[model samples]
Target: MSESYAGKINRKLLKKRRIINAAAGREPADLVLKNATYVNVFSNELCHADIAVAEGLIVGMGSYSGMREVDMSGKIVLPGFLDAHIHLESALVSPREFVKAVLPHGTTTVVTDPHEIANVMGTDGIEYMLQATEGLPVDVQFMLPSCVPATPLDESGAVLDYRAIDSFYDHPRVLGLAEMMNFVGIIAGDDQPVEKIVAAQAHHKKIDGHAPDLVGNDLNAYVAAGVYSDHECHDLADAIAKLERGQFIMIRDGTAARNLEALVPLLCAKYADRCMFCTDDKHPSDLLEKGHIDYIIKKAIALGADPIVAVKVACHNAARYFLLNNRGAIAPGYLADFVVIDNFQDFTIEQVYKRGDLLVDHGVVRDFPAPEVEPYLAERARNTFHVETLTAEHFSEHRPRGIIGMVNGEITTVDAGYSDRIDVEYDVLKIAVVERHKNTRHIGIGFLQGYGLKSGAVATSVSHDSHNIIVVGTNEADMAAAANRVVELGGGIVVWDGGAPKAEVPLSIAGIMSDEPLITVNEKLEAAKDAAYALGVNPGIDPFMTLSFMALPVIPTLRITTRGVFDVTQQTYV
Candidate 1:
């Protein structure tokens, strides 16, 4: 029979019949996992069951004969983890390589906001991410980026207005509008943002939110505008308030920001269903050393959270919030996605099965064929690093009373007291943000006090919100060399010392991700970190990741952009 004609037949009915036959032992199942202890999220209990899979759905969860069977003796079977929110671009690897890195860690699903790419390449960037993630072992879902440039205060490479955003509403992989980082616009009832929210609602799609420290009437107004979820809460009070206001809170535990400790208290039985886990931005080093949602689960358990509730927060809560009804639970008719672990406490994933196919075995990811990269994607490599000229003079700035701040373990920055000059004695350094998108030759110069760089410089084109080139250094010559080197590589992170490149990780893909494998990317990142440490950067912070956030103008207190130093509290250029 022709494949088209065969597909046109009642395949749904035939699949249902097959499932019924397999469960009834009249037909052999495609795969059977026997002698396993299932962590049933639905009932919040453990059950010894033999899982029978037909096609790609759970046909039954009892002793059954099958065409193929694997004895999962003494193993604990849990649903595959779902990362509620993440930025795949932040991994510094393409979606193809990112899947390879996280599959062994048991992350089978991810809902990603491609705003980082959208800010750089506009709608074309969003489409590229969707196309790249097709047919992967992990279930990659795209959340339509709500804010392309993030805010009107700064310029991005491309703009995604309501008209441009509406085009992806019907895309099969599009879950909803991404985190609306432009909370200021939404609170003010701006026409552009308000219209986007209405369009998402009209299409019955959920809208994610990104309001950091938003409270009082403003928070109410922001939520009232139909923004449904938030992943930026850093404390318990804000988390409690958002939960009370009917917003699903994504407890984030990533390399830069670690809020899981403070928010773990909120993951109690009372709010277990409303809380989910997300790594908003995690580098490959962190993703590999510490697992994704699996890491979050381990931390939550260590913090005295119930093991079952922690698992629910990692798996069930995310699935429920995203309306992924088919894969969160190990029940009949659900998608056959399982994470086989030794126990719930340590959360050591031994094997992972997606759609009845084993993808990870013995804690190592089974190699799956990667999708072909279209030739047009290679064309995007040119003209990304558009900086014309960068010099030591660009890093010179005199602000006796101007103060910039840095916060530990958080993206938010605070103002340290003003300084008379670049006080290298006290660890103050010169920070510059160079505009790379339009070759505007615009550079924003300021002083940062916490980098601890006594000499040399660090630079990256992976700046947040607006992916400009941002560099910080003790000496202007090193700063100039580092910034120019980043532009030279098209885009990536670089650390320089003694007026030469110390270490570099090239992210040639839209100047945000490397086309290299995850292992190579991780090695480069580690070397970059070592170089930063050698340059006297504070060991407490991930220098490259921290430098990336310094350019984010949306975060509070003080931030630098290509336009100028922005006071986030005052919401204007200082």
Candidate 2:
């Protein structure tokens, strides 16, 4: 590591300095941020120090110098934050216009699981995501998806297997396996898919797990089976239990979940080392305003978590767990990834850096790479533009209608929770799934619910996993019309009143996300939320979220996914 010996480095730099130091054999860094304050997340101490860089690597430290210097006086520096789990492809592709929403929040990296796109376009979808995130501000690394259709009962865009896993495991950015959602299969020892885990094991990579409400001997079986992490814990006792069982708890905060408060207390008291933070699935509006994992750090601190411990769980622990040494701490031999924040309580981000490159500054992305994506519109906008043609015929008691009962601002659902059934004879209820995959298959039927929808119909192509078209109504024609309108409008959510359409939020990308900017997406989201309220749905949250994840078959107490109806407890397709 000398000046003359520097040319051999790949994507790194070489520099020469005078420390009259021992022959440790080292070159100078490319750039040096001289005289900065370090918030040592490891020891929770603040120290005034100088950082040096060689090529893109931190080759020197402790009052170091280089060719050029960035005088960071009185500025706060912490490690780059990591987003433990996400769906970058769906996040970027579905809403092509919203990637920057999370970039400015000091979260310089993400461990994304591209299952949403996999369900739509299969392995091709994963490939598309890989291609799309080239050289973006944030390090969009991946965990090779563990579940394609997500559940065995549903048919989706991709069918990933041991071959596909082995194929993608070699890529530099591919880190181990994605969240394994097939808890039942793992417990049953059905190794067809579980072998994928074994394959990653051979590669010596980490394994991420997902088992909602798994407890007692079953939880034991899950952890003993080689799965290492869990993010689906809902209750504090369950989270603490999982932590006691030696599973790293990734406390989650997202559009459908607000578990940070419940899980934060544990991370503060007793088991601080065994926890991390992740946004399982966050919409643009949430990411843009509330934040990525940065919000988690702020929330943890606000709830009595030590600042250093909060930053550790928010930044260092996740990278350490996944063994992503390249980007984590602000120390020498690590990537020059960090955030300059004004405070820890509100967590205001002033600047962000990754691999020594400045990405976001002053609340805006200084640079953003373009992503090329094809829109997946279900049908034209006008095709689904009619109102109720019902005279009370869609009701029943035994053949219960598939209903999506939502929890406010959360993705967890009360599956098939209804005492009422579709009265088909009276034309009171109808349910439909529009094939938003652009395959052009649209189907409609009638259903019932105890959640109580008094009028009109709600439609969306935001169905989870498969993201097919989903419409619920009292009238068959209204349901069919709402579904077709999503197709005709090039994909979006359609709301219908008596004999007319009220509001249509056009989500041109795959019928699930809007290609519009973050602000526009939020506006449309509010409109849809309002429309849902007008329809007599009691859940105060925006309807888009409830509609978007309705097709997700992974988590369950109950759900009405695009693949007909699912019985999660029995682990079978009904």
TM-score of each: 0.95, 0.84
For each candidate, the alpha-carbon lDDT, in order, equals: 0.86, 0.68
Residue-wise C-alpha lDDT for candidate 1, range 77-129, written one tens digit per residue: 88889998999999999898999888888889999999998888887788778
Candidate 1 segments exceeding 4 Å error: 1-7, 10-13, 396-401, 408-410, 416-423
Off by over 4 Å in 2: 1-30, 65-68, 89-98, 371-429, 434-455, 498-501, 553-558, 561-566, 570-574
Return the TM-score for candidate 2, rounded to 2 decimals: 0.84
Q: For model 1, what is the error of residue 282's alpha carbon versus the real structure, in angstroms, after optimal superposition?
A: 1.5
Question: Candidate 2: lDDT over CA atoms?
Answer: 0.68
- Across residues 1-574, which tens digit of lDDT does each residue of candidate 2 receive? 4655445553232132322221122434456777878777656678677776654555545766566777878677888888888775344234234457776788878888877766666676666667667567677888887887677655555578878668888888888888888888888888866798789899988889998788999889888878999998878999988888999998988766778888878776488778888888887667666877888888788888888888878888888888887667776667788788776666788888777777788887875557654333223211222222222232112454555445665566665443244553432354545444435343323243433355777777667777666777765556656666776765677887786778887866444556567777677766767776777665655565665565566655455554455556665544
Best TM-score among the predictions, by candidate number: 1
Ten contiguous residues minimizing lDDT sum, candidate 2: 14-23
